[model samples]
Target: MPGMVALRYNPILKTFGERLLASGHAPKAVIGATMRKLVHMIYGIVRTGVPFRADFCSQKLDFQDGI
Candidate 1:
């Protein structure tokens, strides 16, 4: 089932879909959003040498007592 939807599309779409899936996004408009995030992540990692941290995502993280 992995790559099932992507395999049907062109290389561009496949790449977009995979990026979308990797970024925890799944929806009809995932391609565009994923592409944008990919650009930002690439700049952050390559230009700044920083790893992507889920906790620092635009979506705020939940804090539990006594972590």
Candidate 2:
């Protein structure tokens, strides 16, 4: 699955998945959360026309308001 592959190859996604599991999320739920994060990251990049930065982990994105 894309989530599993992301976890294997993407350090950011890997950490996210691990954090979710540590918080008592199920395996499937963690995968789903990672997938959702992947989609949101892609959308944010495209919507903002900005290059992706590996070190970006500041705050939650407010995509609804176009931020």
Candidate 3:
């Protein structure tokens, strides 16, 4: 799926997935989270008519209380 590929090739997402795994999340959970994030990103792109940028988020958004 696209989420898997994103986790494999997208540096930021890959790091996120890896961190989740390290934090004791199951494989399925990681994939589900990844896909969920992809959906949000895609929705944002469609809603705003903006192109995707890897650094669009940068450090402006940080996870709190997991996710």
lDDT of each: 0.49, 0.76, 0.82
Cα RMSD of all models vs. native, in order, equals: 10.8, 5.5, 1.6
lDDT tens digits, residues 20-45, model 2?
A: 77768889988888899899989999
How many residue pairs clash per model?
0, 0, 0
Q: In model 3, which regions exceed 4 Å deviation?
A: 61-64
Worst lDDT run of 10 residues, candidate 3, spans 58-67
- Native-to-model Cα distance after best TM-score fit, residue 25 in candidate 1, in Å: 13
Residue 28 in candidate 2 has what lDDT?
91
Stretches > 4 Å off in candidate 1: 1-28, 58-67
Q: By TM-score, who's the top model here?
A: 3
The stretch of ten residues in a row with the least summed lDDT in candidate 2 is 58-67
| Best-to-worst TM-score order | 3, 2, 1
lDDT of 3 by residue, 1-67 (tens): 9889988998768878888898899898999998898888899999999898988774654463475
The predicted structure with the larger lDDT, 1 or 2, is 2
Ten contiguous residues minimizing lDDT sum, candidate 1: 58-67
lDDT of 3 at 16: 80
In the range 1-67, model 1's lDDT, one tens digit per residue, is 2234443443544555655566676664564554554566568889878775544542322221110
